[model samples]
Target: MNAKTPDTPIVIIGAGPAGMAAALALHTVGHTPILLERYREARPAGNILNLWPPPIKALQEMGVDTDDLGAPCHTTFRGVKGNIRADVQIPDDVVKAYGGGFIGLLRPELYRRMLAAMPEGVLRPDVEVTAIEDLGPTVRVSLRDGSSIDAAAVVGADGIDSMVRRLLWGPSERREHKLHIIGGYTFADVPGVERNEVVLRHDRTVQGTYSSIRDNGRDGIQWWVLEAWNPKAEPPADLKSHALSLARRFPGPLAALVDSTDQKHFQRWPIRDRKPLKRWSKGRITLAGDAAHATSPYAAYGAGMSIGDGYTLAQELTGVDLTDAAAVVAALGRYDDRRIAHTTAQVQQAYVLGKVFHHAPAPLRPVRDFILDKTPMLQKQVGEKSPAEIVAQLDEMGAGLVRA
Candidate 1:
């Protein structure tokens, strides 16, 4: 077997959550990793966000500060009339262990914390990876500036339109969910808003939801409305007005929260993701995060899963000899085996949920709502099963980032 140079670093393309986490975790595992970003600085793509406990634990183990990172929320699915449809029942022990079951925080704050924990000189901004090739013993990453770096392994942590993914597994069409979400956050002390809770409500055709958020020691709330929309159509002229109109459909402080949000804090996103790839690694290169499995936000675990990917990748490569082609391939195969199934399940579930909630037939709307309201189907699927799956990762993570 060809041997790689020990001094060659593992190169990660993209400085998003996945790339950054991978670099940190790799460092924890005693590997030098170079994180490259195409942008001038690392930034989050969206504002409103939530994260499950697995990712939280992963972040903390990687040395990112977890003290009051976000508001701890008891999330529940509700009908538009304020009746609880399904309660997310995360175990109390898990909640206590991770600081919260599902955390509510601004995406930028998360970026800030992760970036703060990042080691200096690891992240190279403004250096775009234009091409990647596996050369048996080493992988070569060509930059936009005509320079190239050779590494023992390369991780494609780039976003949905990942160049490494395209190079490794050809191009695949994006799967549009035909839905859009308008969301925003506010620090205003809006009356009638519940604290420390995520109230996700759905009407016949729209989903209006809000959750408590804590940003930098300040208590606040974040809200969003999701509905079917044509991907090609122009966005609403007035985003706040449109969001407020949707908020009005659901009872309680959703509308007021929307009204209280500053125009600068509001944002909109069209939901889309690519189909899950059957394989993510080939030779000395592998994929992570959206590059491996682009998922819709309906899962609310996209970023969480991305962080988990980095942590898991680091674990799989902990003591493996990166120089040995067989060992590197075996390590990557383990990473794929561990990540693909879980992330793919999430991607498919989120896609199906979007279709069911927003794109369902008009005639079947009442039938679906009635089932969700009366039956334990949703509770079984989302409330119990989903939490079980998420919490299981904590155990699977096996103590910490560094293997014993």
Candidate 2:
């Protein structure tokens, strides 16, 4: 096949946050990208979410209006007794620039903002990509409709069961954390709820937490309760009641938040993630978001990291000639080098946290709690290390998507 032209466009599969961000970032960097979503429209898979500073910066750089996007929250890890175990201290300048240490909001609002900023005709819905072939200078993507298109590159932003990832790297087992989370949001006035704060509390076994959220100028709170669950077992028949029961274990307005939540707002997810791959790109094709690194919610940065992936990918691909196989390979290799180590650390950390918090032995429960309460280990790990990483990412992202 002849070398593809620059106008051939980079094809991005999936329309989730990662895919949409990729399309926006790629467009910002002067690349023509086609975003394909199997579904009729781009939709959020869950409701409640939080984003750190790095993603906020990425959104702004991609031309998405970050003003009043979400509730700015000062997050703290606390015990059931309300004693703060660790305070996530993001730099004041970062908090000011990005809105807060962590921005809490409903997932759908993020989708709406990203979708609004998406270039017209960039996203093609109801188009299912069935196969991908890296043909030296270009990639040919076959659709379920028995049609095909050639692209300069293919980015798989598809979710956990990513077909692109499977094609690049062989299938790997989904490592089930054997944990479940029941989450919901409420716009009603809940008494005793803290404003603009993320109160994450843990009791003996269950983790009940709530964060302030703002949706289209309406202020509210989003909460979730996570516990060890049998992966093979059926979900609770009454999710609200079960969440309420767990919420009651924590001292605060968590239960009130749950009670105020409507039935329609409730959501549940069984936590699972694939092992991080050592490499994310091969030839003219690469991976992004959950396709590259499926993460447990314990990281709270899954979506944030996915947004960062698109931002970073665009930066690496800028000024590179896509028609040249060597140039494409080199650019994708740089993407892998920049993303792999950081994502792998986050994935492993989230997995270990699930094991430590919910799956610890009964006899070690008190010991674990005592250590967490008495020592600065959690403080150093989450409060310090996490912020440092976020700052580092922001630095690495530089001034904008396109290099000066």
Candidate 3:
């Protein structure tokens, strides 16, 4: 926690939710800020999203409530083998107990909200940042139009392909080479597709889930998918055709969701993740959001993590004078130390969950589910898990992450 100091204009790169959230948090702590975006009119692919519990808590602390944004999220269906008709509601009351409840939103709507909350000059849409130079005490952010400004600190919320991370941390070692993700916002709405349920395909080999957003008359519905694949074989550019191809492989209505798509709507990416860095900052230049930690889309925590980072960074920079060189660098180093472990653990946990869910054969799947289905106590005794109070008992000590 930083003590409140004179306002410093922190430069935030990228206008995605992570960058926007960071900008907002910095503003909350009394800082002048500037946010840059590469696209003048960047619109999300209209992907629907359900905020999980931990992030729900994070957002509540940040001041954007899910209940205020849109509809409540309830689990209509989710499971590896069979569609368990469980009331997996992170129930409104349960969510409220934890300080926040879930709310669904269209990407554009969410984008609009974060932008609207900014204090006028903070967000500069259409301004693309081309280069960033670390000047020890100050970082210079150069935009595409050949303009530059010196700032006390610069944040790279530019995403996994973060230019800042590349310049500073270098490309992290590739954690996995081949991950198949078939995603698209679609128009054809399927019957009984609950607006909140995270629908999982029982054809476990083809792991997929769709969060239901309200149907617009044009694009009736939307959903996305992630599965194991060979990157050298099938990359994401061919996402549409490949998704349609994968659609033909499934037996249930899940395939119908895919059949409704044209190539334009199909989006595919060979999901790649970089191993986490021990340091997320270098002097005055700091990486936040996806720049620091990039997780596969399977977890849907990427945006939320950025929000957390933005808030944490704002908290760290509260008292430092931007003009001071040593303070800026030291603050950044401390920021990295605090965040690297937390974010890396999140990324690694997603990987382990991916392995446990996709690769586990049927027999093991039952035993895995049985333990989970029984009670949280059984789960904790067996492993150090924390999905629910009862679920916390699933995993053993240090089972989720590597902490330095």
Write candidate 1's Cα lDDT for 119-208 as tens digits: 899999999888888998889888888888989999999999999999999999999999999999999989999899999999999999
**lDDT values, one for every candidate:** 0.91, 0.91, 0.62
lDDT of 2 by residue, 1-404 (tens): 23456588999999998999999999999899999999999989999999988899999999998899999999888888999899988888888888875889999999999999998999999999988998876899999989887899999999999999999998989989999999999999988999999899988899999989999999999999999999999999999999998888877788988998999999999999999999999989999999988899889999999999999999999988777789889999999999999989999999998998999999999999999999999999988897688678888888888732
Q: Residue 393 error for model 3, in Å?
A: 18
**lDDT per residue, candidate 3, 101-197, as tens digits?**
3444456666666665667777787887777887665677877778777776889888878888899876566667356676766656676555544
Candidate 3 lDDT at 340 equals 74
Which portions of model 2 show Cα errors greater than 4 Å?
Answer: 1-3
- Model 3, residue 3: C-alpha shift (Å): 25
RMSD of each: 1.9, 1.5, 6.9
Look at candidate 2 and tell me the lDDT of residue 130.
83
Cα deviation at 181, candidate 2, in Å, is 0.4
Look at candidate 2 and give me any clashing residue pairs: none
